[model samples]
Target: MEFMMFCRMLVEISFYYSFAGAAAAHFGGGETVLPALLLSVCYILCELLEKHVTAPSAERLQKAGRGESGGAGRFFRYLGLLPAVFWLLLPGMAPADRICFLFPFAYLAAVIWRKDFTLSRYRQTDVFSTFWKAYGIFALTLTIFGGSALLETTVPAALVTVAGSVLLLRALRHGSEVWRHRDYQLRSLFETGLLIAAAWALSRDAVLELLKTVAAAVWNRLLVPVLTVVIVAFSVVFTWLFQLLRYLLTLGHREPQDIGEILQYFTGQGEALTETVVVSDDGSPVWQIVFFVIGILALVILAAVFFRWLLMRAPGEEHAAEQVEKIDHMPPPEDRKAGGIFRNTPAHRIREHYRSYLRCFERQGGTRLPSDTSRELARKTLELAKGTQEGEETLNMHLGRMREIYLRARYRQEVREEDPAEMKRQTSAVKKFLRSRPG
Candidate 1:
């Protein structure tokens, strides 16, 4: 979870820094390193404090209701925006530049606290919302700063923007699926892939240049020398064989000439012989036109094939309906009880109650399949109980509430104090239905 938060932070920083840097450059200002660094530190600290300190504290204060004024919390929270004043106080800067510098800090504070006035834990969906907001800022910055050099500026920024967008999309897709299925292994693998892709995207030019240099070095220092030696050896052997053949041909005739003299004679002849060929072009070349047409036809065929494949690959309405039907019929596996002695924690008690609820359905001969998720199990069970004496809506409500608690207990790092009681209430409702149902 911490790693996931870190990845989100990285995505935020990449877009924010690019936008801030571009703006600073456009204004002919100095480096934005200080502001960027401060932004990163503040973001991390805010996330940590919210998750660990502020959120839990607020939850306690609300439950206790010790006459604590929520307004005081709000006042202190706005104090987080106080750092922007430091930029305003710095000397040797014009009013415009100071205001410009102040915007990033103020914007950073606003983005940090925008969703809830009080510091609250961010959800996975919140990450996407924050990303789009940051992307909007980047787009606006580029539009304002990239007036004349828009093409040149946009080229590099587009690469980064596209890469960040792809990361967020992949995370959002996989994160939701993994959470639903409790697929931690798949999540880890996805995180690894995202990290690799991000590293490659950021350092693609350096990596390519390094590869090119290594190839050149190998050609110059290793392959070239080896090839040279092999060529030299082959030539020497060839020359010796040629002299030997000449001597054999001579037989009893005048003594065969030395290899050196033979080589000199050939060298002189080679230097003396010279020839040149002249060709003239007439009008247009028919072969060029023929090849061009062939190339165009090949391209057209490839494009057609690609589009056909894309059309075939897309999921249709019928396919989506089939998937839904499959889920409806999917068998859910029996709930696995927690191993070892149970702790008296809210999270543990929630899990225990959820298991008991599942067992109530299991007694009715509805078994769980390993592939079925908690929600899928609940849905399938709901369908099974549709013909029973209890109303479908009531059972669905009970199952939905229990499922929510089970998921939080199973996956969430922290469970609220009220979760165990909620789980017990839902489980009792389910058990009551089971007891009243016709055998």
Candidate 2:
């Protein structure tokens, strides 16, 4: 289940990067392909490292230490703000861009300080929220194009639309919480509409620029008005579509390189005059192809979901309800083992239960050091049980015998002359006693 959740987050982050890349291309004049792919790969790798390596190491440090000042604090501080610092320190980052990155880092620090530096306050949702906000900063940094360009192009409008979508999605994602606040939906809708309306105004100017660049032949007294209206309508529709796409792609979760190409696309930095002057009816068809591919991708997702549902069998109601009622009852690893092929071997299962019983011994005041062997731990645990209750004495005797059998099974690789029935009985008795203990 944890692996599945991680995979889902991975997919969502990939889509989010893809969407952000596309938006950057359309509004800020950048290449969407390679940078998006690179960022997605980096994000997934970082997440994998953080979860599997860094987090576990920090947890071990916490276990061996006595205070809140463990590796976890240092990990959170660096993990949360390092990217922001990297972005801000990058050469040629606009002041607004630096501010964008800086604001989030500052806010996170403040929140952490307010919470007494407890990293647990920031959940996965908070991470997603911060990423989206950083995207907004990048989106809004289009003002670097020039104040006039910002007003005349779709950049400002795109910023507003992105902001609205972020807020609206946040509300949707926390619908139950929003429901507790009266007029939350109304306020969100009203704010979103106002931003979109602002976007529509800038979109008209953007359409004019797109028209001048793409279909200059359509520039006549009669058709100019009609073409402008049509292009403006198209821009609005496309903006909304892209916004919806971003929201959907990152519905569960939610980069800047190649500024030179973006600058060229926006400021005509290296373009010949003829390139902008050439009028062709090629725009709509290319857009259609793009939309077609997106539609196909959506259909594939739906099919995947459908097939997944078909393949997964629903648990029986009685078993499902019992599972819910006894949520705290974590059965042994073998009992909850997966039904797939290549199940863990009997030796592996025995090792798991052996470790579990060792943990039980530690809880009962037995000290098992890191250098202690399995046999050593078992012997030390039995020593701790000396002069205890009769029930504990019997349980420890069974545990000692089981440990010897496990040692032989693990190391000797030969069947013992002892009865298999007695071995099974002793193993079961030890497990039953461990589960019955309060700790």
Candidate 3:
């Protein structure tokens, strides 16, 4: 499976280096160029953002001396502004084109958060809400405003925009279905092929414009990753140096005094071993040039080594490792429980909390179930745990997928099907939905 992805990516990349006007000439290069450019720019930006943001954070990780074990992670961490910034800088990109650019970053960020890639995102309502509100506004504009009578006056663009708008809505509503597949790797490859094919379906003029915009966009994304590799390389070198010094210092010395005397001798200049008191005028720094250089170098080197090996090494390497290890070393992803000090995956539990809202088949008495969207009421038990309104529309979008399942489940007809797997997806939607509601 990995090999397949590798081969597919290689093929996609190779078209660049190949004397491949042959392929382009046949398929009509003029058509696909713009989308190819747009996708290429997005692709580059994604990689670069990961590299750059992760690099400095990774350096901090290493300096804190966090080891490779608890790696600085979160697949789509810098999802918010990077893509938007890329789109804004491209003067030629239309608002519609900008949507295409922004959508993927937002989508990827949600997906990563969903997968529990970084911190368990339960209390992370702020992160989830901010990104989706932007997305929801974009969606609202595309679907509602784009479909308005005045906008529809532009016939061809209206037609294209309307089609894209409808598909985006459908795609988002059933997004988890698309993301969750047994052969997800294969599916992603297939989707890329389809996108590339769609690129070919464009008009020549549109293609050229997209290509230029995409080129600029791709360049923007490249900056981040390039920075990441540089930072990692530097931190690793520093670690190596610090570790080496520790080895040398500890090789023979038995006590702190022994090491300290040796360190002073090694750091001090050979000249002026006499105790004649070098005329201290109440301690203004008289530059004993050789000693000063030696002292400064020793202090810098010692501090660096101490930080890398002592204070930082313990936490950066051993400490962070133990914390992550407890979670990863759990019996299985399924066997793990909801609560543990170091076990941070509350995304599932948060989902379950929200799903309990759905069990109320219309309450009867004073003990009736609370309205799912009632923020004030929900605040009594769950301060921040409220979900989006379980209005028929939201439920229909989330829990109802198949026509048969909807009919059977809706009418209370006896039904025996496997339990739904979308509790997590529902939870994420609830998080996104409630975020729209106030405290």
Candidate 4:
């Protein structure tokens, strides 16, 4: 779970930082980009360290009956967010900027308190709600700051990043089902494309005008409380519809991009597609083409060397052998029969019964190997009989019969005649045998 959370944090930080860096670069009044980037990096490192080291150390201290674990852990989590607070509350920032930063920070504290800092709680929270709330905070921040025209441009872009991040997190979580199976991933692409297309449709100028109108209305104090409620309500409705569109687009109904205008609107690449011809006195595109070719070749060569070096230094024979050995020596997982105990399939029902029998045996201090067959497991029961020789023989006979029936039923897929009476009899015998065993 810690490993999974670490991966999630990495993905979250990467997406968030990329967008934040881009937004800062575009609207930072020519401020250096390094501070924002470094702050993000530092926060990520602190989170990773806390999860990997500090939290586990606290757990060990608690297990050892130490009283300082709680205090130590609280201090760590509090310290971890200091970098974010520092960045958000930097000198000269607006009140709204501080609020925007503090809002998520407050949300984090609430989550930690409510969920006891369980990593999965954060992951399981509604991403759509979280995104828009964060978005609303940023919108308010921009309104309060009123420093840059580029600030409004960031709204749609931030929304796009939110969409992508949420989609990516979902994909990564259920990657085996959604990504390994190509159809779902492809669906995600179309969904993402549709989302970006919608953002493009809400052109920058229009969004700016809307924000300005909202800001003006609020400043004029015209039905201020009612306006706030209406704006929040509208934002919710819009986000829900937008999310619904994303959900529906994944149905593989390829929309018609037939008309040139529709294609242009969807792609929104009209400005990007136009090439600027550099007209110099040289009157030649040849030199320009030569420079581009040289640059491409240089990049390719550098990339090849870097990748080759990376591949060569990758985990080698000893590391791989150690990993294999660890896997081989790992204990069997606990029998979690509840998931399939009431499954509707016959196979699952039979497997659940078998697992229950195994659990009984395991509780009696019996160990089963991965390679052990049903016959071997049954034979092992012969050594458990503590009564007279005749009783041992009788127990072995019952166990042998049970094993035979189980093997045929479990392995023979074509066999449809699994007698419930026989299964119940065998289960009872197994339970009786387990109960007879010495602890």
Candidate 5:
């Protein structure tokens, strides 16, 4: 919507100044052409700001580790203020303004390219809100122009009307939080841009005013009334249904992202979720179906009543209720990386756990305990001895037999699991394996 705002603002400036200036320049109105050129400079400033805010990752990598004490702080500071600065500076330099015309075209190109090239990177929450705001302004500006709506409204008044439409656009998008998909953020940027362009064309003044007048005069003024009635019906139906669903979920130990869905449902845009469950090869959904049915029934009765009771209780009661319900949730911090093979994966976690268990035999300088028949730690070391991505694959296999022997020894307990005699021998083997393997 920022782009839309930029476009609309440009169009209006063009309409009053540039169009007039062009006519003036044609009849030797040298003064008029300057304003046209000057308007282009305003566009240039917006583009420069956009680029300064751009997050091209490869370039960002150099600055990523710089922390807060660096040139980045100055760049961000200038990015926010430069557009307004250049907009004010435009009128004085006619030649510069002509050059600046290329700025908007270049920005449009980059925005398009980024939409394709780094599709995932800019998939962020703020993109769409800004897009819709732009769309609404463009749509309104087009409407006024098409209808030949004589500026019966003052220019500032018209700007206000467009601004309000943008706010409404924001409201609609903001209220849509419940139905978002993983790719929703990325796709919204392209879709909103396209839709706003379409809306601008439709709303251009000539088309809409004609359509508006024809429907109003010929159809007994029916469109508005019909729209109102339909809106009312949708609001009542969806609002209650969505709310009840959210209430039940809260009752059943689930939390929702936002509650505005209750309002959106009435807008004739109810959303539904389709989820999946994994079933074994036995091909029986029977157990899953049984559990779902019981859960739903319990959800309806117990959840609803509890929801009402909780709503009526004191605020602290709700906090206490939440504590009673939650078991062992993690703190919302950067406590763990998302992907790793250690703790959460099968083989790696088991290997690491065994190694930690064996750390008791360590002697010095990263060397493990000496070689012995205490095959437990020895086998684990041997398993890992097969080099990683950095090393060769060829290695001994008889120590592999040690895996089985260790498994048997661990179960039989013929020897104490941690006996020093066996530890000495196993540690030696581990040291030998480590010596032979590429470190």
Candidate 6:
């Protein structure tokens, strides 16, 4: 599940970079690498901040049953983007072009930060919906920016989109039991690849031209007019609101001040505030320097505190440890001498015998690491038995038989009627060998 989630995130980030690269290519005269790299860096930073900082804090708060809101953590997360904003500003580009470059990065960051990436919380429909939206944006960007001269940019973007789609499909398939087979996955990929190729071949020229024409028309006829009206209406409303606010601020203080007088007063106050903070003409403001220093210190302090808290064990963990210790010290069931009590179904009986076998092995000083699987443990035991005694083949046979029964019960969810008897026989043979070994 963790692997699948990581793959999904990588696919998302790749699509975002592809779309950003296409837009940067269009606006920056075929220069896509630097802009795409910047966007990718910003995006990855946001994900790290969310995963390591914001998420853990939220989880801890919830666990503690605190009513504290996550607003502060969220604010800090956004604050971390200030350096990226300044980096974008450092480039002397047109305001419109800079905004175009920032839009995809900002949108990607918002999408990633807003969504919880917990595996259990994932929904297939939501993931696919987000993917389609990103793909549409990439296609639109390609259509608008791609021309005969920019085939280099278009080809890379197309390849990235295809790769992302394949990975996302693989993740989807991997999450399901029915479609998890390698052959099934390869078949799906092949079908998707063919579909993408056919679509590209059929729509490479005519469809692209059609889309560009429609986009141009919409921009000229619909978007421009609507934007002009909105700007004009906003200006009028803003002026009215300013006047009302000024009136309220100066109410009963003076008799009907002129608009020019109010503006002059506000400007004077702004200058006063600026002069209070600014200590030099050719350098940054003293307050600005102080603010930067304080922010850095705050970040360092928060990180140290967070790490220290993480190192401390929780009460629940201690309780769980105590419970495990108690279980480890408990006496074995008396039913073990009676060939064990089998209950419920064949699967249950087989599992019970397997557990008994493990306990017996542990009592004989055989350790089972948590990372060892059933088959792995069986192999290790077989190796030990081979080192100690004769009839190695007999011991190997017994272990292999028990391993097969355990695996069938555990994974295949299949237990035949004879599985209980077979499991008992194999387990007894293995345990008998262990009992004969010198302590």
Against the unseen true structure, what C-alpha lDDT does each candidate score? 0.52, 0.45, 0.37, 0.49, 0.38, 0.55
Residue 56 in candidate 2 has what lDDT?
60
**What TM-score does prediction 2 earn?**
0.24
Error of 2 at 373 (Å): 69
In model 1, which runs have C-alpha deviations exceeding 4 angstroms?
1-23, 30-41, 67-101, 116-158, 175-439
Taking all chains together, each candidate's TM-score versus the true structure is 0.31, 0.24, 0.23, 0.29, 0.21, 0.31
Q: Indicate which candidate wins on lDDT.
A: 6
TM-score, candidate number 3: 0.23
The candidates, ranked best first by lDDT, are 6, 1, 4, 2, 5, 3
* Candidate 1 residue-wise lDDT, 311-341, digit = tens: 2322233333233212111111112222233
List residue ranges in candidate 6 displaced over 4 A. 1-27, 33-44, 62-65, 79-83, 92-97, 116-146, 176-439
Write one digit per residue (lDDT tens) for candidate 6, span 1-439: 2233433344443444444444445446333334433444454465566556765787789788975546887654555456557767776664434654454455545544443333211222233444456556646665686543444445444454455455554455343553456776676556545544543442355655766799899999999999999999999999999878778767847544666787799999999998899565566688778977796466446434322321221112224313311211111122311122212345566888999999988888788999989878887677556555658788888898899988877666665547889999999999888877754
Candidate 3 least-lDDT 10 residues: 306-315
Which candidate, 2 or 5, has the higher TM-score? 2
Q: Who is ahead in lDDT, 2 or 6?
A: 6
Lowest lDDT block of 10, candidate 4: 324-333
Q: Stretches of candidate 4 above 4 Å error?
A: 1-46, 67-70, 112-126, 129-151, 154-157, 173-439
Q: For residues 333-434, write the lDDT of model 3, one tens digit per residue.
A: 223223323233233333344445433212211133455333333332233333435453564454333223323333433223132334445544544544
Error of 3 at 336 (Å): 23
In candidate 3, stretches whose alpha carbon ends up further than 4 angstroms from where it belongs are 1-44, 47-87, 91-184, 199-439
Tell me the deviation in Å of residue 23 in model 1. 4.6
Collision count for each candidate, in order = 5, 1, 12, 0, 23, 0
